[model samples]
Target chain A: MTTKRSITVTVNGQQHQTEVEPRMLLVHYLREVLDLTGTHIGCNTSQCGACVVMLNGEAIKSCTVLAVQADGGEVLTIEGLAPEGGLHPIQEGFWEKHGLQCGFCTPGMIMASYQLLKNNPHPTETEIRRGLEGNICRCTGYQNIVKAVQDASERMSTSAETPVPAGD
Target chain B: MSVPAAFDYHPATSVDEAIALLQQYGDEAKLLAGGHSLIPAMKLRLSQPEHLIDIGKISSLSYIREEQDHIVIGGLTTYVQIEQSDLLRKHFPLLPEATSMVGDQQVRNRGTIGGSIAHSDPAADLPGVVLALKAEIVVQGPQGKRTIPADDFFVDTFTTALAPDEILIEFRLPKATGSTGSAYDKLANKASHYAIAGCAAVITRGQDGSCSAASIAITGATVRTIRARAVENALVGKQLSETVIAEAVSHATDGEDMIVDIHGSEEYRRKMAAVVARRAIMRALERI
Candidate 1:
């Protein structure tokens, strides 16, 4: 039999202390244990983007990461993207640009887009396509998704008063 | 979803600790880097080992630096880190270019170079690139540390020279000489991240503007990434012309033992390998 271990992790800006089995995936911990089901598991394989999340400010597929691997680390789920009453620029862009049809891939797509924008605030259309190549959206045909990222880039660039350095 | 079968979890903060844990567990233990590959396999029951030694927290094993004679990349350095490193862009542009093509942004964020090398999937882009670059793999075991050339590092399909108690530390690539350039070309599968046929080429031009040395490594067309000696032999002492490049590409799959699957037939892969190798070599030569 496997042993259960105590792990302390910060999820979506909140600390959670829990005991989990060695086999528990970070996706399971987020959905079943912490009740943050915003992170969906589309495919057991890592091919799908439905399980994408931010660990230590980098986008990763949570389904592939074990909870023990994430011990003592800070994780950002789709829930954390819009912590305040207002939606994040990416989320707003998705809605305004009609980036989704069934909305199954939205949370992961939005999280992936957030990471891309964080690193390259203003990405070209080709860059945006390459950035999101891992995220498979079965619906929408990706026309609006690319449009959403472009819209988010424009909105973010205009809202900022102080100029942020390129390539953050 | 039922939980992954029972397995012990050992979190190691240092290389020594990780090596010790691997020794204690023997062949029953597997090192977990980003869990991008092993974990998914475990979930599918393809690999049901007794223990998982987690090494993701070893922050010291994540860096990309330029040494006096070579570029050293920590084993735990994520693909995303390589994609963003200015050092890689300046010294090893081919590595970053290939890394950028790895399974999207999410996989790049979690997959480590070491993990990918250790897994040694024949279709993986890095293995082929490293082979062409003539890189070296540094491994730490219970006994001590040793460096294995990239050619000898990959033993067979999904296998490496890594001992049961050994942990791959980092990879080192010698600095390119003057008039040297490299390129990686991959025909990516639409659904799965596996490559249909991938080729990596490194070419060094002579003082007379002719090819002095050439190395071409091919992946996804064979059981393991193998250098195309026929192509390399044909390129040396030849001008970087379209005819010579085509002749070189024709011999790319001369000695390859290719893998045939539903993705493509062995005949198709053999043909594509030749085409891609020529394209990659031509592109590399253009940059020289």
Candidate 2:
């Protein structure tokens, strides 16, 4: 018999202290435990980026991370990107630029782009393509996705007074 | 959803504590560093140890500092950290260059230097880089701490010299002296981004414009990472030109078992290894 470990993870801005199975993955903990299903699990083999999330301010695939491994760590999922109702700038870009055809890869794509634009405010088209190389959108050939990121970069870079970082 | 088999998770905060846990669990325990490589295997039910001593939070075991004549890097330093480090860029330029090409952005954020090297994955890039730089691996067990040369550390694919009770602590890389240059080249498999053929070269030039010292190591193409001593011997004391480097790197797969996987064939990889080795050597030469 295996014992359950108690872990506390700060997701978005809310604190959730829960008991989980030792083998439970972070994505499972989010979806099944905390009910944050924004982070998807496409391949489960770590090849696809559908499970990407911001763990301690760095992007990592949630399926590859154990719930116990993320003990005391801060996680920012797609659910936490904006307040309850409205969309974040990157999400707005996707909606405005038609970045998604089926929207399966949007959450992971947005979370990844959130980090990329945070790190490099003004990313070139090549940089955007490189930044999103891990994500796969089977519906769109990614021409519009690149435009969506470019659209977000301009929106975030221009709108801020005194240059407040987009994702901070 | 694939899940790991039920196992006890022991989070150790110190090296001594982790070593004690290892002694307690014996062969049933496996140290979980970044959990990138091990987790996937566990999910596939390939590596189901009875216990996992979590050592990722051993805060002291993650750093990159210089002590005397050597550059000391702790085992848990992430590839992204190594890629952005100014100290490594100033002292060891090849580390940053090699790290930037390791994996995609998310993979690099979690995979650790010590974890990748200890796993000894044939497709992993850092193994060949460490072997090329001739770094020393530091390991600690219940008995005491010991250092092993990079040449001897990686015994075979998915294997290392570390016993079940010993944990990799850090790597001690000798600071390159004089005008030294190093590079890594590979033909990456598209989906996994792993090398079908990878070569890493470190060369130091003498004041006479000849090769003073050379260390070349290969991965992905072979069953294990092996030192290309014949290629190294051919370059020393010779003025390295395109023709000489081409001739020297021709012995890249002289005596080795080439890996044949779905990603590539033995014949294809053997041919790619030579071309990749020449490119790596030529790039190193250009940097000098």
Candidate 3:
């Protein structure tokens, strides 16, 4: 028998109160309970990084974290990246650079890139490649994905008044 | 999707609370540190603890401070914090460098040093590095806190000297003094990013450039991380040149039951252990 845990989590600036089993994973809670299916589950292990999300502004693998573990934390999925009418720079870069083939790994790649670019507004080519190491893209060979991140960094740097520095 | 079996989750806020929870649950409970390793093991059914005492939220256990003659890092300090620490980068570069090779950015953001040490994976990088640095770990239990030397901490594969009711608190390492250098060299398996063979070496050179003291530790070759005392003995009092260091590091794989799995054969691991040790020694010498 499993015990159900009631948790309050803020997702993409919205507060959510839900009851979940202790064994329920964050990925399932997002997909099934809230119907936020943008976070994909690949390999079902932490290594793949297909289920990456922004937990309190840090990129984390949602598949490895239980729903109860994320209580009282802020989570940002790929669904929240774009505005009501337009796309975020990261999404725009993906569209412009054709960052995906099968589109399975795009959400995780975008979320991971969101954190990377937030920290480093302008990263070197090697830095861009190394930054995306956590999010694996089987389709595009990561060339376009790298280009997309670089493009997003460029776009974001030109738009924001004061760019945020990488954390200590 | 892989899901963990049914278990009770308890988020602990303090060390005393954590210890008390551990005492109540006994061996059926597992401490949840960053959950980078524990979560994966639980999801795969490799570990099925009835209760999980999460120590991640205990702010008191997350710190890195410089003491009188040593540096004390709290058990919950994440790898990302260690990697970005200017103090660690300037003083103990090997720790930050080795931690950078742990996993991708996300894994480092959540994996804690104490959790890694307690897990004690033979292929893990921090164990060998800590062993080479002669770091001491603090474990707290019902009785009180006790310090355990790095050498005696690791008992066997996936096992440590930690009792069921004990929790590792922090690691204390003596500050690196003048003429001391350390390096960690690893050959990682591309798929999982676990080390195939890793070697950590710390050397202190005299004014004459002759090695005064040396500590060489190896992982991924044996069932447990161990110091290569023969290699250390051969390097001391000897000028650290290419040939001399090479000869000394040749003993890294001696007298050990090397791990043989799909990654590499026993012979292959032995050969690579020597190679990594040689590289690590050379790097350490260069740093000195």
Query: How good is model 1 by TM-score?
Result: 0.95
Give iRMSD, candidate 2. Answer: 0.8
Which residues of candidate 1, in runs, are more than 4 Å off? A160-168
Report the C-alpha lDDT of model 1 over B1-288, residue by residue, as the tens digit.
735678999999899999989888898999999887788789988889899999988999999988999999999999989988998877767788888888888888889999999999998889998899999899998789999999898889999999889999988999998899888888888877677899999999999999999888998888998888898999999987898898778888886788899999989998999888988887887777
Best by DockQ: 2
lDDT of 2 by residue, B109-196 (tens): 9999999999999887889999998899999989999999998998888989998888899999999999999898999888777888
- Best-fitting candidate, scored by lDDT: 2
What's model 2's lDDT at B272?
Answer: 91
In model 1, what is the error at residue B152, expressed in angstroms?
Answer: 1.0
lDDT of 3 by residue, B1-288 (tens): 589889998989998999999999898999999998999999989999999999999978888888888888999999999999998877788999899999888898889999999999999999999999899999999999999999999899999999989999999998877699889999998866788999998999988889999889998888899999999999999987889988887888789988999999999999999999999988988897
User: Can you give the TM-score per candidate against the true fold?
Assistant: 0.95, 0.97, 0.97
DockQ of candidate 2 relative to the true structure: 0.84
User: How does candidate 1 score on lDDT?
Assistant: 0.87
> Each model's DockQ?
0.72, 0.84, 0.78
Kindly report which residue pairs in candidate 1 clash with one another. none
Give the backbone clash total of model 3.
0
**lDDT of all predictions, in order shown?**
0.87, 0.89, 0.89
